[model samples]
Target chain A: MRADTEQDILKTELWWTALVTAVVTAIMLAIIYAGLVHHINPPSNIETVDPKTLHLTGEFTEGNLGTRVDGSQITSRIVATQFAFQPQCIVMPANRTVTLRFATPDVIHGILVTGTNVNTMIIPGYVSQVHTVFTKTGDLLMPCHEFCGLGHSQMWATVRVVPEDEFKPGPDGRVTCDAR
Target chain B: MALAPHPNYSAQVPPRVDDAVDDVALERVMREVPSGALALSLLTVGLLLLAWFLMYAFVFLPRGMVG
Candidate 1:
């Protein structure tokens, strides 16, 4: 036994435990907040498109199967068919907001960008749209997540996010990975 | 006057305790933690923070938007 001050005797182990728990909780909350506001995993916007005649006309035509830069926003159009994503290698500039538009002329399929939160279900007769900004410059692998057919394992694409200084768009506003 | 020692029982001696030596050993064990252990813990925390920051800035940020 040892002598103790009256005020010091009032403190207990519970106080220390609560303080430690509060610090841990605060750290977890901060991480979650940072993840939510950082625009890493964006939500998908779905719209109806006629699957039977999607290739006939409109923006999903074969000529517009890749990325097209508009006034301020960049739009990427992709057609997910039986076993491949048309224009497997799409190009975009890093650190810029981009609209990713996907449509399937066949059955339902899902797309997920590896190392990213960009995941959406590409269903026939509908368009899956996602708007996001690329912050890093590299090749991002995009694979079909949903099972479509026997060759589903081979259905994948690459998205090249080039640095803004290196991105070169042609007079027609078309960009592809091979252009680099 | 009426009590007698049991034949099966034997008197035992108490173990010797040196108060000064025992107190010193106890204080050394309980008073402070090793400086190396504390430094290692802090270093681990710093490394964890660094890894988290790098992953967030490079990997997560560059992957682009989902919504």
Candidate 2:
């Protein structure tokens, strides 16, 4: 009778352990299901500017900012891979918000808008967003915040803000670099 | 002459059941099972969570902008 009682105890203990394991597994699955079902299905992106606003996109080549500045597109001989990121001195209308989508192909960079309320990381696999209204009309330097390489300390670009009515086109109907 | 307490003790006795347990082998198995299982399970769950977060933030985010 004693041996029978011991065997029953062992069986009961095993059953209890198995029951606990099954309950824990069920709880984990329920949590994952909840996350998959209601956790914002996915992330989202905001169109922070209109189509008429200035939009620049290109590869940062070695030597200059590799973007055309002709009537067709804003192209420049500014090679960025070798030299610091020499962004064009943009003169946005006062009170107009400019949303610059900074991107890099080689390494991570930072778009630091001096004397403004915007600083962001420009990572390779991530699209960093910086939105700001030009409340004042002056020159703003875009400096690299992250220690990218040997020339990181001096890496920067220029952004020029101007009054609302001072923005005009050049002789060729294209907004030249000096139009502001 | 004291009746010898059944001198055929070895003749009619059932074999002794070995009830002694080896503590060393039990300790080794006890130490191995939980550690190995815990390491593998945690690694699998962690990787799964990371991939899920990245995909959700980047890929699906762009598509949601359509509507």
**Model 1 chain A weakest 10-residue run by lDDT:** A1-10
lDDT of candidate 2 at residue B25, scale 0 to 100: 70
Off by over 4 Å in 2: A1-82, A86-88, A169-176, B1-67
Clashes of each: 6, 12
Quick one: best DockQ, which candidate? Answer: 1
Comparing to the true complex, what docking class would candidate 2 get?
A: incorrect
Model 1: CAPRI class: acceptable
lDDT of 1 by residue, A27-132 (tens): 6775575568765444546579999888898889999889888777789999998899998989988878788899999999999877666888999988898877
Restricted to chain B, the TM-score per model reads: 0.52, 0.53
Task: Give the number of the best model, judged by TM-score.
Answer: 1
DockQ for candidate 1: 0.30
Q: Model 2: what TM-score for its first chain?
A: 0.52
lDDT of each: 0.78, 0.52
The true-versus-predicted C-alpha distance at residue B27 of model 2, in Å, is 51
